[model samples]
Target: MTELDEPASAGPAVQLALRELGILLDKRVWAPGSRLPGERALAGQLGVSRSSLRQALAMLESEGRVHASAQRGWYVTTSVVSEPPSILKSFTDNARERGLVPTGRVLHRRVRPAAYEESRRLRIAPAAEVLEIARVRGLDTVPVCFETTVLVRARAAGLESVDLTDRSLFATLEEVAGVRVLRSAYSAHADAADAEAARLLGIPVGSPVLVGEEITSDQEDTPVLLCRSVYRGDAYRFEATLHRSPD
Candidate 1:
């Protein structure tokens, strides 16, 4: 019987096959569209069961290669493809799409006198009533950022009754509360992590961190989300494309 027709097996053989595959990938041992040797062929060559080879390929598919179709056998990826990062497709959408899980422990959310910075960010009088929300957000169970969000209390009345934990705040505002977030302008800088930011992000105090501030508005251009977020430097990477002018 051929390798394709061979019986399945498990364990150390499975692991070895996978290890060899990894080395091959690192070396590009198989070019794009290269058909791996038939299962029986590989199993015999690797001294493993055909079943084990199949299991190894299954794992590869999960890693974004080795596409399998109904009638066609597995094939190496012919295109440059990567897991699209999680996106905010809608307020109700999941952050996990971009490989980030949106989880937060809410620290504070109440109408209080605005801080001097909050007053300017939210365009309210100094000490004017505003909602101050502090949270430590996680990605894949790892703390990646700490946020202190301030909003115009008068503009977002009834927030005292809203539960803002372990869920997307932007979703709650737009979808559940009927408020809108049109666009936000962001400014980012590098800073040394303070104790609070360090503790929340599981980093050492004085470590490099990313400080980002944004002011969001509504369809009518009324500013809405005014918040600052400090992201851990080691765990976060933000990429963007830009056009440069000729010298």
Candidate 2:
């Protein structure tokens, strides 16, 4: 029988199809998170029976190389970007370490009076002027995080006028304001995407997301910035090394 007529149980046929699909993915014929063609089309294109194609797809799913969506067909899983909890690194630095291009789009920027909570977080008096900056952060043009940062205006003077698009905020702070981020206290939790977050991250509303909050301090241990970030759950991973306590 021809390859297209091979049964699903034919191991060779499924393996061949799996290899072909892997090559396509490596070449990025379809970008991360993009839906593949229908099973029938994919089967025909790969010169395999529908059953064999399904078997190959199942293998890929098991490997976390792709995922099936209810009613939406199979999608290429996004390349996961990971950061260790003990390391404090900028998004740009993390992406570059993984050979991905980091990008950002400034969504909003202004000087505003600090709210009560913001004042407390920054250890500044209430109503103190604060510079607020919001951005959509991405890897290779794929949106991954939405972030907002607030800092006392005096700590980062002239920062509001800096062009942040496709740039690192941490780097800019050091360069322009000479305000180095020496340390940060951070926390994260699971969340669902809201409408604005969905639009910015290019995901459906109610999709899984990771919400993170951080307060960063400078050399003197003075809080300099408070930030909140929402990350696409599918595209990001947080990792930490653990040790057993002494008995």
Candidate 3:
């Protein structure tokens, strides 16, 4: 009989199951963001009771290694992608620096007249033409962020025709439009995923997410692009270095 078959005490059974589950996760027996086996099958394979397996899974969940859905069973958590806020880098650059394959899928693209809010954000006249693009971004096939970007159409002539799939917007701007983004003003907050964000990021509606907004500027400090992003809370981390101000 296996050690977990029928332990004299529940504690040992739980510990054994936890160890087994940890090993599986460490070895990537299940890939990140992939659903785990059902509790019954997993419990039987580990020779532990469902209750014991549940306790182990709970422990893993607390450690950010797994997550559970109300009706969809358990899933392996995606690896956290960390970015330092002090540096300015494109998503593609950051992912490549971490040895992850970056990917993008453009969801929506159009040229439209800028509304009051859009013009205010982009520093353009109301009703001016602007290019709007929405995309889903991922690393290693795990969707992590949904983003929307808008810019004055005149800044990037023919930009609407560029195929942005698997391409970096920063690179495209430099190569196709001779526009270089030099800096940005950014802010973020904790928010619940809305229906649209949930659908794009593949998370349940109301799941915790990090929402960010940025205004990018050219060398002359002219606001050239406005971007908004929603990032999965479980899959992304923003790091910053804090320092005390001089007296």
Candidate 4:
């Protein structure tokens, strides 16, 4: 059957359950190895019959979305795509959109003279003051990444006192600094997690991780923030849509 015709064949309850499961995975509400709610509870929550729920879960399991543990119940196998390429969103926004809670813990925040690299990236005078923050970011109760972000001090006015534990840097910048992130130039690569990153993410030292770096710009194309993030490879998935060039 064609892709479009497949959904029509699924019973309404199965279809709804599939959709809900997709959202939960997408938002990282259930991290890898997380146990799903019991069958009766889950069926009640989804307003579906036990048989329908089992069928829907079977489909997902076949697709690697979840797995059943003998007698222990179902669990998510991995994290789904957290962000879509066409839209730029903050970590908090991405999580919330997918039915998960986003949280951050500031490990360190300081205003110091910009280093050579920071100055170069932000296109500011050397030795200029800059605000740098290091944070451990998570979805629900799962530790997923650790990030270090830098911003030119002048562009981050009033940000020194903003509470970041339950907020996003992108949101705070827009609200307090009136800067909008129009776009970002980013790159990512696979790497082994270092001691600190491993500790923060509750992974073993030298575990595989995705390392990403980005330079974000405002609506006017002015560089605003520089960020380096390390994500736990097993608990996160990256997704992007590809478009063919027009002839």
Number of the top-ranking candidate, with lDDT as the measure: 2
Off by over 4 Å in 2: 1-6, 243-247
Q: Write the per-residue lDDT of candidate 4 for residues 120-211, one digit (tens) a residue.
A: 98999999999999999887767788999999889889889899996989989999999888798877889998988878987668877898
lDDT of 1 at 77: 43
lDDT of 2 by residue, 1-247 (tens): 8755666798877887899999999999998877899998998898888889899999999999998877778888886777766888899999998898999999999998999999998999999999999999998988999999998899998798989999988899999989889898988899999999999998889888999899999888989999999998888888776789999
Winning candidate number (TM-score): 2
What C-alpha lDDT does candidate 1 achieve relative to the native structure? 0.68
Taking all chains together, each candidate's TM-score versus the true structure is 0.59, 0.91, 0.84, 0.70
Candidate 3 clashes: the total is 0
* Native RMSD of candidate 1 (Å): 12.3
| Tens digits of per-residue lDDT for model 1, 67-130 | 5544446655432212123322321143465544566788877778988877787777899987
Whole-model lDDT per candidate: 0.68, 0.90, 0.88, 0.82
* Candidate 4 clashing pairs, residues 3+ apart or interchain: none
TM-score pick, better of 2 and 4: 2
Cα lDDT of model 3 by residue, 1-247, tens digit: 6634654458988998999999999999998877899998999998888888998999999999999977879999987777676877888888898898999999999999998998998888999999999999998888999999998899978689999987889889989999889898888899999999988888889988998899998878888899998999888888777789998
